[model samples]
Target: MIGSMPILLPVLEPDAKEGDGKEDDSGDDGQRLANRCFVIGPDGGIIARYDKIHLFDVSLGAGESYRESRTYQGGAQAVLADIGPAKLGLSICYDLRFPYLYRALAQAGADILSIPAAFTETTGRAHWHVLLRARAIETGCFVMAPAQSGHHADGRDTFGHSLLVDPWGEVLVDAGRDRGVSLFTIDLDAVAAARARIPALGHDRPLTI
Candidate 1:
């Protein structure tokens, strides 16, 4: 559900291709493509959709840089949906780095966080596991991430280690660098137990910056 989807360009704006790396102010400063994720119910209906709020715009050395904002528009709002057994929070790839969004979702009653991503080989090798585990530990919510692996059509490589982490920061499943389906069982009761033991989510206080 996390992938490329195109949107109509604003009438007064000029068309800019995906890899242009040019700044765009049209479409209210949004991109022509959206990095969107969806929540689907078991009955084959769409429950909710979340456009990624954080775009991947970084330099990875070797004269390599990505400007996702040039092609994909970032979402302005966080989304939470009811998926029968649990309340789910929807987020696309780059949004994983933003811990505040996940915390807000957890505070808003999300039992599971879905972060589907296409992380590059470089960053994924370094920060993938730690970040995912950190988010689960911080929020006490089960995390289910599905990532793209191997070479891509754009001459870029992705680090694919699809993961499922429990609320207690236990890795239930780790689908290594391959293309296949991974299945794991998650116990929803663990969420409440973890939170009851830590209780960090309830300890937040207003701070002055």
Candidate 2:
């Protein structure tokens, strides 16, 4: 799965003025930032683009810490796009932790949710499959996750096992702990059937607690 494309944006100094003798390096020649995901149409055209709202910023102990916000700016909006057969909700790695985002996408008419990730071995083993299945069951939408597996050049080991979960929370396919391609067919009609049976998405009531 392709992650977000990093784009360069100009960084401006707020305090520096024109005659302050500070270097004039604004506009087009600044820093490379922006975690953006895109939906490319069959015609090789851009259909939709989404910036990843959630950034991975945590310390897993053992001196391992990630500060994604250091170089990349988090996205502010969630994007939904129509890809012919199904309306897709676009998201990147860390977005899986937030179920509300998936629920909102389903309510907004998204039938398929794409969450491409490179999860660490620790968290993936603990929560990956469970979370993916839960999301599908909760939203009655198909969950398609393509993950990065095995070791990388950066000296970090990733947890693989890419999964495709159906609307009923059934795992249609799992890619195991290695890097490989997996194929599976989904019935979009099942989305409606599952939601019809549970009807939980429409059962929300205001809470006073």
Clash count, one per candidate: 0, 0
Candidate 2 lDDT: 0.80
Q: Which portions of model 2 miss their true places by more than 4 Å? A: 1-32
- Identify the candidate with maximal lDDT: 1
Taken over the whole model, the C-alpha lDDT of each candidate is 0.81, 0.80
For each candidate in turn, the TM-score is: 0.86, 0.83
> Candidate 1, residues 1-209: lDDT per residue as tens digits?
22221111111233323444655655454436766665655555677877778989899999778987666656688999887678888787889999999999999999998888889999999999999999999999999888889998888999999999999898999999978987556789999999999999999999999
List RMSD in Å for every model shown: 6.4, 7.4
lDDT of 2 by residue, 99-119 (tens): 999999999999999888889
**Which model scores highest in TM-score?**
1
- Which stretches of model 1 miss by more than 4 angstroms? 1-31
